[model samples]
Each structure stands twice: as structure tokens, then as C-alpha cells.
Target: MSTIAAISTPAGVGGIAVIRLSGSEAKTIAERFVRPLSDHKATYTPFVADGDTVDETMVTYYQAPHSYTGDDTVEIACHGSLYIQQAILQHLIAAGARLAEAGEFTRRAFLNGRLNLSQAEAVADLINSTTEASNQLALSQLRGGYQQKLKEMRQELLDLTALLELELDFSQEDVEFADRNRLLSLSENIENEAMRLVESFRTGNAVKNGIRVAIVGKPNVGKSSLLNALLDDDRAIVSNIPGTTRDTIEDTVTIDGLLIRFIDTAGIRHTDNPIEQAGIDRSMKAAKEADVVVYVVDATDKENLNNPNVPKIQGTTILAINKCDLIDHINTSTPNHIYISAKTGTGLDELKHAIVAPFKEVGDGAMLSNLRHFEAMKCLLAAIRQVRQGLEQGTPSDLVAIDLRDAIHHIGTITGEVTTDEILGTIFSRFCVGK
Candidate 1:
């Protein structure tokens, strides 16, 4: 195969950037740009271009079938000058290496069977990870945790399929190779496993992305201030007057390894002002859609909290009594209340802990965070349900077998065992160029 080369590290100025080369001729291509740093090198010698040996650098080599793409691979770490990086890449291209396409390295890994489709996708996730939770999840997937689980489930289905097929082959002999009770149990087990993975996607997806947390309250209740405090920046404008914020301002914060997207919405109130009323409508909409609602109340305005006129709260609303520093004395009668001075960053840590508490019950380790995987699991569960119903109704083995096969197909979709070109294209296209 032809050698492929790309700038593996991110673009722009940095301490260093990596240029990666892989394929049958990767070593040969690298040899052109790198000059050995030592005569009898204990470690692999650093290389520099023959004509332009400005600075010595390190070089490591991996032979074919053992490298990232299952091809000979070489990574060059050099000073991150755009011109210098481009020069090295250009020299490699001139020396018979072609530029790799977006995600080509990972795509090659998949094509070479070194990694499955799911694992290859995890490569992108790892690179794009912006939060600790996402990074851990991606690492788990990259290490084959998710793939191994899927493989076990698929093997279970395949075993049952094989037994069913064998029984059909011996139909003329009237043999009962697959016991009825064992078959039902196997189906149940597979269904339960799939259901568990399907259920985890809810929390996993939220954690992989940011959990949407919306700040809701009447105007001038320091919702914007709380947002700025949580984000550690003035992401939203603050004002002493009410109805100052006319739209939702979103900012992401990474707390306790979880990404939380804080959306500070316009204050909720019944206002005759057309612009203010429109903002209030949007606030209500954001409140309904958010995963968690931070219901901010002015500490001085105790009557508003007890007022029946306040709009009905929804979701897991945490009442944040803002402006606590201003109040001479604060009471603790309100349910699920936290006192905070967003201006002074008081009780913010406690609020962050409370926000992440609900998700802690979700087990540590790998989870099915991909939406496609979630959908496939859901389909598998439906098919399994059909099979279960068939068993309960004493349906013929043939009918149950059909449902089982359908379930297998849905499971296969997650690992690309039953995927299409369009699906593959859609998935890999999301990757940045030169991955």
C-alpha cells in the first residue's frame, strides 16, 4: 500500500506539533525527512532532513500489523511553526507519500480490522473531548470496553441462531437439538443486557455532551449573576434592573469532570411589554426542555417564593436563594434551597455538587454514549420484546426464531456488522480532516 502522511496534531501555533506517516513505505518516506541523531543509538535515533538539519529530533518506528493502522507508522515531533510543519509534510509528499483524508488513519485501522467501527469512532471522540467525563468515556471506548460488551451480546445471539439453524436442518429427523426452556432463557438474557445498555444512553449521552441546566426565575433575581459565577466569567450581562436580559445566554462549565451547559434565560414574569413578554415565553420554553432547572429567587423577595402566582416549576428545580450576602438573615424553610451570592461566589461549590449528585448513581466505567448505538439498542429491545411475547403465548419455535433474528440484526447495526455505506459516510464525515 501507498504511504499516507498528515499533521496529526492540531493546527496553529503550539509548543510542538506531530506529523504522522503510515503505510508499507512509511519508514522509507520518513527516512527522507529525518537524519539519524547518533551513530550507535541505544534508543531509536532522532532524524533530520539531510539538507536542512537545523535541530536534532526523536524518531520511533513500528513495523506493519503492529502499528495504529496495522501498517508501518512514524510520528515526527517538531517545533510548531506552520511553515516548518508544512515543509516536512511537503517533503514527504514529494517523496511519494499522499496526504491522508479526514479520519483516514482511523478509517484505515477499521479497514485493516485492527479496530471495529465503534472503536474507530471513539478516536474522534477522544480528540474532540473537551471535558474530563467525555475524555474518560472516550478512553473506555477506545480500550474496547464497549466493543467487548457488544461482542459478548452478539456471541450469545449467534449461539442461539446457530442452534436454531441446526434444528431446522434436522427437521426431517424430528430432532429437538435446542431445548425450549434454554432458548427462552437465552433470549431473555440477551434482551436484558440490551435493555441495560439502552437505558444507560440517557445519562451517558447527557454526560458525553453537556447536561443542559437552565436558570429560571422572575426578573431581577440574579439569575445572570449566578450564570456568570458558575462559569467564572461574565458570560451574561448583569444589571440591577429587572427584564434586562431579553434572551437566553448559554455558557458551558466543566465541574467535577462533567460538562454542564448553563442557560440563563430571560426572567419569567407576566409583562405587558411585548419584548419582555416574548423573553418570558422563551424562558418558560427553556425551563421545560432543560435537564435541570435552577430556580433562582431573590432572597429579599420571600413572598414571591410562596406566591401562588409564580409559574409551576418543572423538572429537578433547585431553588437558589441569590443575594444572600445582602440579606441580614436568611431563613431555611424553602424546599431544596441553596443560599448563594453569585457576585461573591458563595455556596457555588455546594450548588455544583448538588447538580452532579443525580448522575452519580449511574455506574462508573464504560457506557453506550453514542446516539446511534442507543437507537440500535432500542430496536433490539423491541424485537426481543416481541420474541418474549411469542414465548409467553406458546408460539411455535419458528415464529420465535424470526423475532430473534430481527433482534440480532439490530444489535449488528451498533458494530457496523449490518450497516450501510451512507451510514459509514455520515459517521466518518463528522471527523476533522487529517485525523
Candidate 2:
């Protein structure tokens, strides 16, 4: 295959940028730009490239069958000036290296059978991770944790399939090389694991993205003030009048190493104004869908808390009593209530801790972060259900085998053992160029 070249580092100026070349001609093409640093002219050497030298760059070479793509690979570290990076890349292209498409290097790794689809996807996840939890999940996947689990499941299915196929060969002899009870138990175990993986997708996906925490209450209760305090930025407009915020404003804040999406929703209240009513409706919707609901109540107004018009709180609801500094007579015994003065930043730390605690419990470990993996797990679960029903009825081993194999195929889809080009394109195309 021809060599492919790209600027592997992020665009714009930085301390340094990396230009990568991989494939059969990688070493040959790299030699055109970079001269060997060693006196002995070793195949692998630290060197500086020719042309407009941005810096005394380091060049490392990896030989075929031992590199990232299972082929020759070269990496050049150059000064991060855009002009120099572009000049080096253009030089490699002129020296007979084709420009790599988005995720082409990773695609080459997949094509060369170096890594499976799940591991390849994890590469992107690791790069985009914004939280410690997300980084750990991605790193685990990249190290083949998910792939190993899928392989074990597939091996069990393969064993059952082989036994079933052998049984068909001796139909007249009435031979049973495989134990029926053992096969049933294996199917049950696979089904249970598949279901667990399917269920984990929800928590995993929420962790990868930030957990949505919506601040909802009646207007002029300092919802905007609360948002600004949490973010440590005055992003929303604060006002004394009701319905000052006519739309939802979202900001992300990292709390306890987890990213929490703080949404300042328009206050929920009955209104004759159409725009205000629409905002109220949106607030109610966001409240219902949020991972945690911060029910903001004005500490100065005891009447607001008793108001029957307040929307029903759901999920993990935390009652945030705003303007605590101004209220002398405030209830301290309320369950899950946090007293905070958003204007004064009182008890803000406690509020942040409360917001992060729920997510930590939801996804502790073994979370499946990819949606495609989740969908495949769901499909595998359905197939396992069929196998369970077949076992309960004492159905023929042949029919049970079919369901087992179907479940296996669904599981295989997660790791690209059984997948189509359309799915591959959709998965890899989302990656940034030069990855």
C-alpha cells in the first residue's frame, strides 16, 4: 500500500506539531525529508528534516509488522507554526505520500486487523474526553477491555454452534456429544451479560457527556443567580421581575472530576403572556428530562414554597433555598434542602457536591459509552430472550442454536467481527481529520 501523510497534532500554533506517515513507503518517503541523526545510519533514528527548519525536530521510525498500522510508520515533531506544519506536510505529499482522510490512520489499523472497531472508536473518545471518568472509560476500551469481553461471549457461542453442527452430521445415529443442560446454562449467562451491557449504556452515555442538571422554580427566585454562582461566571441576566429569563441557558461546570451541565431554565408559573408561557412549558420539559432537578425556592418568601402551582419534582430533587443571607427565619430540617445565597456564594460548595454525587453512583464501573454498542447489546438481549424461551419449551437443539448464533452476531457487531461498510463509514466519518 502507498504511504499516507497528515498533520497529527491539533491545528493552530502550539509548542509543537506532529506529522505522521504510515504504510509500506513510510520510511522511503520520510528519508526524503529527514536525514539520519546516528553515524551508523540505523533504520530507526532521531533526525532533523530539510527545507525551512522550524526546529531541531525528532524523527522516529517503526518497521513493518511492528508499528501502529502493522506497517512502516514515521513521526516528525516540528515547531507548531502553521506555515511550517503545512510546509512539512506538503513536502511529504510531494514526496509521494497521499493525504490521509479523517481517521484514515485508525482505519488502516482496523483494516490491517491490528485493532477492532470498539478499540478504534475508543481512540476518538479518549481524545474528546473532558472528565476523569470519561478518560478512564475510554482508556479501558482502548486497551481492549470491551473487545476481550465480546470475544469471550463469541467463543461460547462458537462452541455451541460447533456442537450443533456436529449433531446434524449424526442425525440417524441419535448422538448427543454436547450436554443439553450445559448449553442452556451458557445461553442464559450470555443473555444476562448482554442485558447488563444494554442497561449500562444510559449511565455510560450520560457520563461521557455531562449529566444534565436543570434549575427550575418560579421566576425571580434567583435561578439565574444560582447558575452564575455555580459556573463562577455571570452568563445569565439577573433581574427582580418574574420571567426575566425567557429561555433556557446552559453552561458546563466540572464538579468532583465530573462534568455537570447546569441548565438555567425559565421559571415555571401560570402566565397570560404567550412567550412567557412557552418558556414555562420548556422549563417543565427540561425538569422532567434532567438527571437531577434543582428545585429553587426563594428563602425570603415562605409563600412561594407553599404555592400549589409548583411543578412536581422528580428524579433526585434537591431543594435549593436561594437568598439565605436575607432570610432570618428559614427551615433547616427540610429533606435534601441546600441553603445558598447565590449573590453571596454561601453554601455553593455543598450544592456542587450534591449535584455530582448522583452521577457517581449511577456509573461506577464497566459502563458502555457508545450508542452503537448499546444498540447491539439490546438486539443481542432480544435474541437471548428467544433462546431462553426455546430452552423452557425443551425445543430442539437446532432451533436453540439458531438463536444463540444470532445473539453472537449481534455481539460481534459491537467489535466489528460482523458489520457492514455503511456502519463503518458512519462510525469513522465522525472522527476529526488527521486522527
lDDT of 1: 0.79
State the lDDT of candidate 2 residue by residue for 241-339, as single tens digits.
888999999999888778889999998777899999999888989988887889899887777655424456555788888999997887654566888
lDDT of 1 by residue, 142-232 (tens): 7775666667777777787678778887877877766667767867887887878886876778778888899989889999989988988
How well does each candidate superpose onto the true structure, as a TM-score? 0.86, 0.88
Quantify all predictions' global Cα lDDT against the true fold. Answer: 0.79, 0.81
Question: For residue 25, what is the lDDT in candidate 2?
Answer: 84
Candidate 1 similarity to native, TM-score: 0.86
